[model samples]
Target: MTSSTHPFEQEEVMAYLDGELSANRAANVAAHLRECAECAALAEQMRDVSVRLSDWSVEPAPANLTKNLEAARAEHVVAKVRKPRGFTGRLGGKFPFLRNRWVWAAASVAALLILVLRIGLPTARQESRQSEGLQLAYTEQSRSADTPESKAVGTASDNFKVRPAPPALPASRGSSPKFSSSSADGQSNPEPTAPMIARTASVSLTVKEFAPLEASVKAIAQRHNGYIASLTSNSPQDAARTLSATLRIPSAQLESAISELKQLGRVEQESQTGEEVTKEFTDRAARMKNARATEERLLDVLRNHTGQVKDILATEQEIARVRGDIEQMEADQRSLQTRVDFATVELSVQEEYKASLQGAPTATATRLHNAAVEGYRSAIESLIGLGVWALQALPTILLWAIALFAPGRWIWKRVRRTSVSQS
Candidate 1:
């Protein structure tokens, strides 16, 4: 490797001539070739030899060379099949097509594809079926909601009636359907259609009696089978007391509750609002139905799967996600139903202001009495606190006094001696 002595070995020179050396090493060999005539001659001979080898060509292969080799291989395979010694050979002899690796790979791929289609098709079919059902349900609900007069007035309880079982459809992938058309009485039933509404009311009242107002509000809520969600009462000096509360009452009893609350005081302000939620509720129900169907299909896939671990795990993960969505949709549906069932009320009550001369004198007398009592108590507490402080600090004071007495006495003597000397 050192350029001082023999920088280039014969093999290095050959490698340089063959263009196999790294860039820097090839450059060094090229530079050395320029300086040393012997290595330069060797490199030139190598290049000439490479050129001659490149020009040299073997005679063309026989046109049937590949055919001859394949024929030989086929004969060897035929001999092995005849002997039929090992298990593979016996199988090959019995089944002549089992010898190709490409055939095995193809069969494996075909089986895998079949399994994937089996699992996938059911899910796709379920989704399509569920979507069709959802669309049908939505269309029916919309038609029903648009023509209110044609549909008879029904109560909220009627709206929650169990839907009639749908007609039986052929199950896919050999799995049984979760729903059926037969009722307990073995008769086809019809679907029930009802409107959903969420109601809210706000009322403000001015009351004469402030003390009994809060209790009356609670009693009214209890009587109506409702609860107060929130309540705030403010009573300031020389100001009327005001009470505000948010109440949740059943929609059936909302009117009664509000009427009773009005009776408790004079109604100053009252407003009621209702929102139609038939479409929203219907949409949520449709989506929830589809999710449940998808979940069922996924479960079927998981049960019948005979694939890799990753595939099984992926299927399980998808099932879990679908289940979570289904549960969330169910929760939302319940929440919407509750909103339709319950009515919210906002109530505000203000106590009537009554000017009175009677409280002034009485209040003044009570304040005077309280002030005298507090003054006496304060004097007694101050005396007791002084006594406690003396008890706590008396020992420490005495110790300091004792320690300073000798120093004080010596200073006094020195002062007296100095005064005598000055005199």
Candidate 2:
């Protein structure tokens, strides 16, 4: 490695004979060996060592190794013949010759699928429960306008609650703007909500664009002093969303709001209903007055009466009853206020847009093309699923496939003979 020494020194000369010298350095060694008898003798000695070691040899391989590999193949063939024709077996590649095993696996899958289709799939218990819950919830919702029991609780919290009933229509009408802000409370002078027939109207529509409709609908509802009640949106075939929302706007804004909503999209469906609760309202008015009169008498007794322990307790009880009655009446008033302040309109909106499609409303050729493409995609996906399932059950499927198939059955017997004979 050093630059100072001759590369073809005697040791280098010997290394050259051993073929261990670097090519360029070996050339130098070869030249030295040629010029010096002593170095050439060293090279001769190294060559002699190599010649003596060349006599070493390894033992020959056994003749049966090929036979063993072949036997394994034959046994695999036999095993394939004996297994059951189950889907898992058909798809599994545990056995040889089941490389396209997904077919059997798919067959197995088809059995369960066939059963499902033939019998008609039963609803999942959880889904059934949820449906029942929604039905019950809807039923409950329908009945919860205002109630005598809820009104009797007698608290400020009652003002925030919604009760089951047709809300009382205020005497004033057509006073509030489409949408105008309230200071949360009446000011020096405030216009009251007008008496109007309580009603519910719902509409379903499909729009090519959703954002504009969303914004416009929201604006209209706000203009009407309404809030969105509920919403849901989803699209299975396209990257589009269907939106369903219930907007609660002031009854005064009803007509304008409906017109604006209609302008947003082509209407698919529409329905409306008006509910009358005049007699019910009248009955409540009378009951409230009676409660007030009872309460006044109780207050008088509390202020003026002095009696035994039992008498005082009895009077106190009456006072509590009257107070409860008064509280109930106040709760009813607030419920009526809410109904008078807002109206409910349920709307369902859908956007129609699919990126994969070309222009709208074409002929059957386009439909056929799209359907065929979709069908092909579905088939490929099904095959892929079957392949995966077979692969997963490969160990088990192989056992069966080998037992059932021609090559697999042949290989199976061979494997059994070999394994048994070897044992």
For this target, which candidate reaches the highest TM-score against the unseen true structure? 1
Residues 158-259 of candidate 1 have per-residue lDDT tens digits of 222122232132111111121111122322111124455677899999999899988998988877666788999999777788999998766656777889
C-alpha lDDT of all candidate models, in order:
0.67, 0.57
Candidate 1 local distance difference test against the native: 0.67
Candidate 1 stretches with Cα past 4 Å from truth are 1-192, 355-423
| Predicted candidate 2 versus true structure: per-residue lDDT over 228-294, tens digit per residue | 7776666556567788888875554565677789888999998765554334444564566556655
- Give the number of the best model, judged by lDDT: 1
TM-score of each: 0.43, 0.39
TM-score between model 2 and native: 0.39
lDDT, candidate 2, residue 391? 88
Error of 1 at 112 (Å): 31
